[model samples]
Target: MLTRTAIYEGTIRDGREEEFFRRVREELEPLWRRFPGVTAVRVQRMQARDEDARPIAMILEMDFPDQATIDACLASPIRPESHAATVEVMKLFDGRFYHLVGAATVLAPAA
Candidate 1:
């Protein structure tokens, strides 16, 4: 499996945190779920982080069967739609976002 993770690094505007998250769920999530070949979509809202670490308000993970599927999804028409929606959602945010694609490896628990 391959995962494309979007890291939203920065602070959410004061008093707009709830609205920011709400818009992400209501507006962006639907478009994300529609991406072709997407196996899973996960959104993480930061609750706490190391005091010295850079602030991260959210993280978005989209899983696909492989790199090819991820490429196709990114090349699809839905990509633009999602980008537009993301711009709207970012109005309440105060930082930048970027993506990292990597292979996923799941390990069984040690017995």
Candidate 2:
């Protein structure tokens, strides 16, 4: 599988944290779930990080079967809709967000 992760490398405005969370769950998630070829959509609300490192408020992961699937999805008409939703969600956040795609491996737990 291929996974794309987007990390928000900044803070949500002081008083807008709660609303930012709400908007992501209510508005942004639905749009992500609708993306073509996306097999899974995961959002991580950061709780802690290294003291010397910059804060990552959230992380979003979207999984697809392969890079070809991801490419097709990005080229599809729905791409613009997703971009528009992202723009709206970013309004409440002050951060630099970027995405990285790579192969995903699932390991079984050892007994």
Candidate 3:
């Protein structure tokens, strides 16, 4: 499987934290779910990290069967639509967003 993860490192605009998450759940999540070949969408909320670490408010993980699926989704017509939604959602944050794409590994216990 392939997993594309986005670690959103930023701060919610003052008085916007509640609204920010609302849009993320209501607006942005659906876009990620509808992406072609996306098998699953997982959203993680972070509480706290090290004292001197970048504050990552949230993490998004979208899983696909393979890289081909991800590439197809990226090239699909919905790309522009998703981009627009991303732009709107990002307006709630104070810093930049980042992403990484890689193969997912699931380790099983040895018998």
Candidate 4:
């Protein structure tokens, strides 16, 4: 399995925390679930972090069967639509987002 993760590095604009998350759940998540060939979608909101660590407001993980599916999803018409939606959602945030793609490794627990 391949997982693509988006790291949202920054803070939500002051006084907009509640509204920010509300918009994510109400707006962005629906569009994310529509990505072609996506097997799963996971969203995480940061609660606490080490003092020295960079501020990460949230993390988004999308699972795909393989690179080809990822490519197709990225090339799909949803890309532009999602991008525009994301830009609207990001207006409440004061940071940047970056993505990482990696092969998933799951280890079995010892019996």
The candidate that achieves the highest lDDT relative to the unseen native structure: 4
Model 3, global lDDT: 0.89
* Best-to-worst ranking by lDDT: 4, 1, 3, 2
The digit string of per-residue lDDT tens for model 4 on 1-111 reads: 999999999999999999999999998899999999999999999999999999999999999999999999999999898889889989999999999999967989999
Off by over 4 Å in 2: 108-111
Clash pairs detected, candidate 4: none
**Model 1 off-target regions past 4 Å?**
none
For model 3, how does the per-residue alpha-carbon lDDT over 41-70 read when each residue is reduced to its tens digit? 999988779999988989999999988898
Tens-digit lDDT track for model 1 on 29-108?
99999999999999999888997999999999999998889989989999999999899889899999999998867899
> Which ten contiguous residues of candidate 3 have the minimum total lDDT?
96-105
How much is 48 displaced in model 2, in angstroms?
Answer: 1.3
lDDT of 4: 0.95
Candidate 2 local accuracy as lDDT?
A: 0.89
lDDT per residue for candidate 2 within 14-110, as digits (tens), equals 8999999999998888888888989999999998888998889999999999999999888988779878877887887888899999885678999
- Highest TM-score: give the candidate number: 1
Residue 21 accuracy (lDDT) in model 1? 88
Cα lDDT for residue 24, candidate 1: 92
Backbone clashes in model 3, listed as residue pairs: none
Worst 10-residue lDDT window for candidate 1 reads 98-107
